[model samples]
Structure formats: C-alpha cells, structure tokens
Target chain A: MNTTGPDSPSRRELFRMIGSVAGGAAMYQAMSTLGFAAESTYRGPVDLSGAPRGASVLILGAGIAGMTAAYELRNAGYKVQVLEYNHRAGGRNWSLRGGDTYTELGGFTQQCEFDEGLYLNPGPWRIPYHHRGLLSYCKKLGVPLEAFVQVNYNAYLHSSKAFGGKPQRYREIKADYQGHVAELLAKATRQSALDAAVSREDREKLLESLRDWGALDADFRYGANLLASERRGYAKEPGGGLTARPLPSQPIGLTDVLDSGLWQGIPSGDRYDMQTALFQPVGGMGRIGEAFARELGPLIRYNAKVVDIRQDVHGVTATYEDLAAPGTKLQARADWCLCTIPLTVLAQIPMNVGAALHAAISAVPYSSAVKVGLQFKRRFWEEDEHIYGGISYTDLPITNIAYPNTGYHSAGKGVLLGAYIWGQNAMEFTAMPPALRVRKAVEYGSRIHPQYPAEFDNGIAVAWHRSPFTLGCYGMWSEAARAQHYDNLCQVDGRIALAGEHASFIGGWQEGAVTSALDAIGRLHQRAIARGKKA
Target chain B: MSIRHVTIRLALAVLGLSAAAAQADDASFMPIADLGQANGEQIYQHICQGCHMPGGEGASGAGFYPKLAGDPRLASWQYAAVTVLNGRNAMPPFGLPEDRISETRTVHLSDAQVAEVVNYIRSHFGNTYADTLTAADIAPLPHPR
Candidate 1:
C-alpha cells in the first residue's frame, strides 16, 4: 500500500533537508551513503616554487610535521634548520627494536630485547588509504609498503562476561549476526511491518536483497544449513571421493548473539579509517621517519632541546641546549619559526607569542596511552589459531592483542601488541614498573591464549606519559576546546606558526601532521613572499 | 540494566561463583580484591597494568607519561590517592571495582585499591621509598579533577 503523493520527497531528499536544517556535519553524515565523505585534501605535493632568497626558517621538533615542512621548504630554496631534542628524527613516529634503550621522564630505562627484524612501532603503525598526504610522501621517499590486515575472519572476539568467558571467531560472530538481522528484517517486510518505511515495490526488492546478503533460506529463516555455512564456515569440508559430503554449521540465535555483545567487534573493519587496503611501511613504521631523516641528512640538528622561543619584529631566535654537550646554550635565528613541539611541553617553555596563542597552547591537553609488545617463543597465533595479522579485542586490562601484520607464515619468533590502552588505564600502566607491565600483559593475555605464559620470551612496554620529550600520547581536544582555541592554535602569531597533528582537523593521525605542515608552509611562504616584496 | 543484560549478568555471576572455575584458572571472573596475591605489586599488576604499562617506567610517545618508577613525586601519598580517585586532566575518573561503570557507579576503584596501586608504583622499579598507604588515606580524597 503506497501512501506517498507527488510532493513527497525520497529518503535522499529527506536527508538533504535534515542536513540543511542541522549543519554541514549532519549533511556530511547524511550524504556519507551517497559517497560524499572521505576524500583527502592533499592534492599531491605542495608547490612552494617562489621562495625569497635566503629566507631561513627555524623549525623546532623534528617530528613528522616539522620534517614534512622542512622537506618542502628546502626543496623550494628556503634555508631550513631543524632542531630535534632526540638524537633520532621522527618524534612520535618511532619504532623500538633490539639494542634500543629508552629512558623516560623519571629516568626509568627500558632496553628492548626483541629479536632482529621484530620491532614495536610505539606510534603511527598503520597508514589508511585515505591518508594520501602521508602515503604520497611514502611513495616519494621510496618507502616500500605492504598490506596491513585490518580484519582477520578467523580472529577471536572474547568478552569477559559472555559465553562462559570463551572466545568466538570473527566469522562465526559476523555470520550469525548478519544472518539473524537479515532474517528479522525479511520477516518484518513480509509481515508489512515496514509498510510506511518501504514501498511495496521496494519491499519485495529488500526481501530479495536481505536473503542474498544474509545468506537466508527461501522461507527467510536462518538455521543449520549449507547456505549459512557458506558465509559462517562449514563444520565438515567437502572433498573428493568418500569425504565429499559436507556438514553445515549452526548459527547462534539472535538473542544469544545480541547478548554476547561480541557484535561490537564486527563493524570496526567497516569504519572509514580502519577499512581494508590499509598499509604499513616495510620493516616498521619508523622506516618513513628514517627515510625522511635520510632525505634531510645534516639539515636536521640532533640532540638540541629548545629551551626558549622568542621573536622580535625582525626574526625569531630559539635558545636550545645541546644535550650531548651540556652547560652551553646555543641559539639559532631565522626569519620565521614553525614550532612543532607538543603543547604539553611547549606550555612550560617561555615563548613570546600572543596571549591568545599561549592560552590556546595551554588549553589543549594530551592523552595518556600505553602499548606493550610481547615477543613470543613462536608464532602460536599463526600456528594454532590461524589468525595471520589482525586485532583480537578483549575486555581484559590488555584491550587488544594485535598480531604482527608482517612476517606472515614465517618460521621462528614473532611479536604481538599485547595491549594498546589509553585514558585511565594508561595512567595506571604509567605507574607500574616496566617489568611488571610485561608480566601483567602476559597474565591478561594468557586468558585469551593459554599459550602466553609458556611461549612468552621477553617484552617491552611504552607508556606515552613517561617520555621526557612528550609527556602524553597525543593532543586530545575536547569539542569545546577545539571550538574555542583550535583557530588560535593554528593561526600564525607574528613570525611564529604551529604545525602538527594538533593543528589539523584530523588529530592523532599522521596525515593530519603532513597536511597541516603543507597548509602551514603554504601560508608561511605567502607571508615570506609578501615580506620579501616589502624588503 | 535491561532484562537481557540482567540475564547475562546472572549467567556471569553463576560463573563467577563456581569454585571449580576459580580453582582451575586465574582467568576466571574472580573479584579484583580476591585476586590480589598479597603485596602492592600484585595489586598493581592486577589493576594498574592495563594503561600505566607493565613497567612503571611508563609509555612514551607524542607526550610524556611521567615515569612512576623512582619518581620523587610520591613523597606525599595524599597527592597520589587524589590523582587516582579524581583523575587529573586527560585521565578519566576510574576505579569502580570489577569494571561496572554506570551513572550510579561512576567510579572504578575502592579506597584500598587506590592506596595499594599508588604504593606499588612508589615502591617498585628501582624506587626505595619505605612508605605505605591505606584505604583511610584514599577514602577522604576528592573526585578526579
């Protein structure tokens, strides 16, 4: 029964109206189905062609944002000097491996004991397809990339309270949930429960679509059948001769599936940022930073910690301590300064920026996060569980157990991301000694995989809060904080402008840093050219 | 909780009460307080190991997670307890024992848990502080800022 008249708008038209009524965000969300969202703003490389001769820019912090800026500015003929606090480049984009010892804020040194080739990318591990800016740089830098498996069908999804605390396979949960939801929707359509929502013509089409999508029977019921087994996996395999007969697997009922709450794990792979076609740099995520370091060479000054940042009408002078040398404070002068020091650290340092920018810097707080990389005696996850490279989530203190994306089907040892936790848990992990954290990770992990204790060899944990350079993980801006201070933070205050993940819309992402660097440089170049014209 | 959620909880509670399951493995849903095998270290391992990291050395990245091991900051137990209960800045207010975080039950820890975890951090990982704190020290603390 159709009740729509000529004036009645379609669903797309209705969402457009809602978008117009609500805002751009609402419109964006509404139009997401129409393929409107998720296009990277980076249009290849920045063309910084017209740079004034000998216009030097002092960049603080040799992080991705700073390096991106320096890499572009130097190519455009600007004299660039980057002061990095650490001996190595890539501030947060770091990878820890064997022989690397990290001494955090309070002087607790952690010596990484992972086998050769096995490393922990403590920051920025996965690169999304949509992050074209970083990806383009990767391609330009000749960094070899490989697929980062976002979802493994055979990975386990365990809840502390569900199914007698047993883990369910991703395929089993996804198949059962989809099959049940489809069956219910088909039933609703057949009973005309959705008469107002779907037209009669659409109803028949929807029913047909549900059957195909849900792997439902002709009667619209999902049960123990070959059709269901095709999506969920078969109990018995069909082969040649006597073993040719196949047995179908039984799907969990809708109630049980919903009650298990394992359904939460199903849609993570479907999210835009976490979708398929994700890539990780070959070897480790730090390869990109290392490549950037290789590209810049001596332009980057290592072991220089900026103690003070001051700017006059003429130029900006930053006083930095040579960590290797001690006692003496050296100064670097430039026409302009692009500081990428995290606000958490920058707030404490004396900088003569405007009150608004200073307030903006102090307003935004950084997140606390902890990650543990456990080296196992063998790749038991691959050998026993058949989970090649994906995340297995649990409610235990260790939030996720991410199997290594690389080294699939390789013999010998492997590393697993035992836990990647943030917020309160991070603070807690921040308090435990490094050895204790590894022991707890092993203990918590053994719940999901009983092989953890026996197979666990050595482990290292990184709590972002303890790092001397960066006291937290990343800038976590509240909506109110972003609304009030985001523009101020990003704005060029005199000869000083900030560029980092914190300066962009896409915070906590490497792309944000890259794009924000490009955007900051473009604006800074225009100002430089204007100043050059006046001179 | 909804009826379904209640049923799930009841099922979990039954599993929790099973003596056989408790005897079988530490993985079983035992109480957080019950699981502490003496020492502030074990308590810290059970509760604090998730985020503070396995090592009190603390994780490092874009920002600093001030190292608790050998940290001079724990000179005052009051400051430590307050930080745990009320949570500072980006840290969420937590310690509702057993992870039941709801509107009625907004906190994630008891006073004793806070003292134990805090003391654990102060004492372990090359730290030589001979200080101990109790639930009384933590009970009067304000909510995390």
Candidate 2:
C-alpha cells in the first residue's frame, strides 16, 4: 500500500554497496596503503583564502582547465562561477555519437603512466614516455584503465616513388643521400637527448639549437630528395610519401623524420614509456569531466555563455548571455577570474580592458586541425592479422588509423580511423566539401586495406573550422612562441588567472591544460593568502 | 584592441541574427530542443525506476552498484547503453536475452519510453547534447555476448 516510488537507500546502504560488490572500501584501503593518497594529497587543493572564509573567483571557458580551477577553488571554499562562450563545456575536448558510434572530434587520446600518465597526445605526443596529468587525474577520480595501442612504433614512409621498405632503384640512389638522412636523424636524437638532460629552465637554448639544425636538416633533406629522384633515375619510380615533394625553407614548414623505426631505440629516456601509455577510462574520458561537474552540482550552469568580462580594482564582473534564452542576460561578480578558453577563440573575445591584455593574449598562437573520423562497415585491418589493429598508415600523408577494440563490449566488427591534420592541410581539409572529403578518405583508406574501397559503407567527419562554437582546436607552440611566452602565458592578470593545455609549457596537450589549471589554482591560493595580508 | 572590440561587436550582432534564426518555442526561456524532452520524468519513474531507482539514485547494494542518479559515466549516452543492455560485471543483461536484441523493444523499453527516460535522466541529472534518445541510439549494439 505504501508506494513512494521505491525506498531510497540510507547512507548505510550506500556504505554497504561500497563494502561489498563495488569494492570501494578495498580500493580505498589499497590506495591508502600504496601511498597513492599520500602522494596525491601532497599536491593538495590550491589555497583559496589564507585569512577569511569568503572570496569570489570567475573562470572563463568550461574546458578541463577552467573546470579544474573551479573544482579546486570551490573545494577550498571559494565562491566560483564558470562562464563559457560555447553552448557547452569541454572546449575542443569533445565526443559525439552518430549512428551507433562514439567518435571523438576534438583532442581525443591521453596516455596513462605512473601517477601522472604523461599524455601521449595524438596531436603533439611524439614525446617519449610522458604521461603526467592524464594518469594522475584518473587515479584521483578512481577510474579504470586499458593499454594504449603503441602507434609510435612501426611506421612506414612512402617515398616519392615507392613505400619505405625498398625504394625503386635503391642501389642507384647515391649513398650520401641516405647518410645525410641518417646524420640528420642522429643530430635530432642528440639534440633531444641534450634537451632532456637539462633542467626545465635551460630547455629554451637547446630548443633553439635544435630548431636551427632541424631547419637546416630539412632544407638539406629537401635538396637530397630532389637529387635522389633525378640523379638516381627515379623519374619512373612511384611517387609514394604523403607530401612527397618538399617546400622551400620558411618560418613554418613540415619535414619528414627518418623513415626507419630507429628512433624507438634512440635511447633518450625522459619520464615514461609506450608500454605504460595506457588509456580507456572505465567508461571514457568524458566521465572525468562529468565527475568534476557532478561534484560541483548546480554551480556549473549550462547554456550560460559569457559575452563580456569587466574588472575593476575591487573585483571582476562577467557578463554572460543565457544560451538557452538569447535575449536574457546574466551577470556574476567575483574577486578573481580564470580564463581557460582556447587561445584561438580567446584572441577574438571582446574584452572590457585595453590593449595590454590584448597584446598579452595575441602573444599566444594556435595551429588549426581537421579531425576526420571514418567508420568502415567491417574490420578490414583484420585481413592482415599481423596489422590487426589497422596499421598506423604512418607512411601516408594522413595522421593515423585505429581499430578501437580494447573496450569490453566492442564487436571488433567496425573500424574507426582518424586523420589529425594541421596548418594548411588542416585548413584545406576542413574547408573541403564533406562529400569530397569522404571520397579522399576512402581513396587513401583503400590503399592500406583493399577491402576499404568497397567495405566502407558510411562515415562522418567534423570540420571544426566550420563549427562556430569552437572556431578551431588547441594552440600549438611555434619555436619562438615557446622561447618567448611559455612561462608568461600561464601568468595571471591580477584576479584573472589563465589555465588550459595551451597555457602550459607543453602546448596543445590535455596535460598542458590540466597541469596549467593546477598551477593556476596553486597561484590563486597564494594570492588569496597575500590578499589576507593586505587586508 | 580596436580589432578585437570590433570583432566582439560584430560577433554580438551576428549572434543576435543567429538567435532570431533559431525556431523559438512558447517557453522562450527554456531551449526549444529541451522542451520536447521536458515531460520525460514520469517515464523514468514507471519503467526505469525499478533498476535505476525513483530519484534516479540506482541499485547501489546487494551485488552490483548500478548508480543511476549521478554516475559520472552517464555523461556519454554510449556508456549509458552498455550497462542498460549488456549488464556489466554482476548486473544482468536487460536489453538482449541471447547475444542479440530480439526486436525493436530492446531493454524492454519502447523507443518512446527510452527517449522519455533518456530525456528525464539527461535533463534532470547530467548533460546530454540532444533531448530525446532516438531508436538509432538504442539500436542493436554491434558487439554481442
């Protein structure tokens, strides 16, 4: 007779769930015993207010960094509000569902290693064994993990005439050309070694030297490629490498790395390894953001897009228009504001402050990207079981491909391939009509798996450049940008703190965003304490 | 600074146009897309409340803790489907009996009912891009037992 829509479980029931099947208590005990908690607690939440109880903080852009700043500040007992221009949070970090498929359109992959899994970014993750923030946060949130397919190894380069395995008329090409490439690879390896050896402080000098050498090496390689083709009678050879032809040296130019897989053994150990670059959350990365949002509860108001930011000597006021209701305007006042919006969009924002802030923001630059997600009707990669995971397609001009089979329930019937393009290629790729884009993807995909020509049934792609909400992806650092602005980009403007992966020393990586947010939180806490002294 | 100021002004102006372009509903305050799914709370109560619970707290004790209330994993609809159909860990499979979905009435929830519950949960608890869960979303997942 008493039907109250089922009895709500008491706290005891919750605790019982933890003790029994959920394994919550056991996990907690393990975490504590293993000193995981101790290590995590050392980092601690950023100090909110050193002296008083109440302080206000404003965060811009609801991406990982802004969300993290809010989490830390709110947990530390500071009033926080996040204003996002986009209709939703998670900036360039986003996932979409289409026709029974989950595809990541933005910054997709992260590697888990050690407590702080150094993010082996699919974007700029060429670094050796560097999972830091990605792994640490997963541990913090109690998420499960799976191994990352080591795509770094086993890449084949298609040359101007043939695939990398054996160039046509290989015996005819002058030996100096091969030696030149080997020398350049060795130099790159040595420079990378030097960069790794020094303290984080002295990395700029090494980076500069490496950049100069890289340019020279690329130029020499360009000349060598032309000569190799012409003198070695390669006119009849097949044009193979993606971007097989090289361009003149300029401010920003892409060059080919050594085609051989020798770099894997180059022996420059940083902090981690590919074997440990594990990914796969118990659910997925989106879960992390959800956990952060749930903990904050209603504090995170969706559909509130901050339009304008105005600050005074006393406090900061953020002007936001409710995205759900266009005509409505909402204002929130805070003592501090953290802006984690990607630099690309941030550069265009209408600021109440003057040119100095503009100059500071303009200093941060972003590279464009077009992520193409192709879903095949069947797993064509399985044809060559040796290349079971759908080979990286490394030799092609395209980014990479994968068979996402690691999850517990994956059918292994479908194949998900993505191309991470940047700069002009990215712009061109995104600008191309969707139909043309699909055709080009199919053409290239078929080369690797003959079945792809016919087996490909349906696909979807996101030209982020066209998405008005998120104009483009994260910022990639230029050589000069790194030397000039890496340290300064993370600096807070009074109560305004900047946080995002682009704000970190390692620009264009999720680790950069989370790490920078953590750094900003630390600084905000310090400022709060300093403010107490001033009071 | 001038360029940015002008850009913002232009952006606001453009935003105004875009807003006008959007089809406005009677409840102008609530999004037009959200209004369609606003009435799903009841469906969640009647059909889903058994496993996921009434307040949407979910089955926490006995054997498997299928937290429906605020499990962060529910943010993505794909993750939401896995447990609802396959029955992860100790939770029994609800959508399909023998490896494959027998018919359109997968998970014992009709397309409308699924949409209603999905809307209820997403609107009330977590963030979902769309209001209603389409039949395509609850379509037979490629992977079976």
True contacts kept of each: 0.17, 0.00
Give the worst 10-residue stretch by lDDT in candidate 1 chain A: A26-35
Q: Name the lDDT value of residue A313 in candidate 2.
A: 79
Tell me, by DockQ, which candidate is best.
1
TM-score of model number 1: 0.80
Query: Which interface RMSD does candidate 1 score?
Result: 6.7
DockQ of each: 0.14, 0.01
Error of 1 at A294 (Å): 0.4
Docking class of 1: incorrect
Candidate 2 chain A: 10-residue stretch with minimal lDDT: A27-36
Q: A2-80 in candidate 1: lDDT tens per residue? A: 3365323333343344334434221010110111124457898898888998898999988999999999999999999
A228-342 in candidate 2: lDDT tens per residue?
Answer: 3343333344455874644321111112222232221221111233333446543335556656666667667777666677788777787777868877999888887788865
Error of 2 at A225 (Å): 32
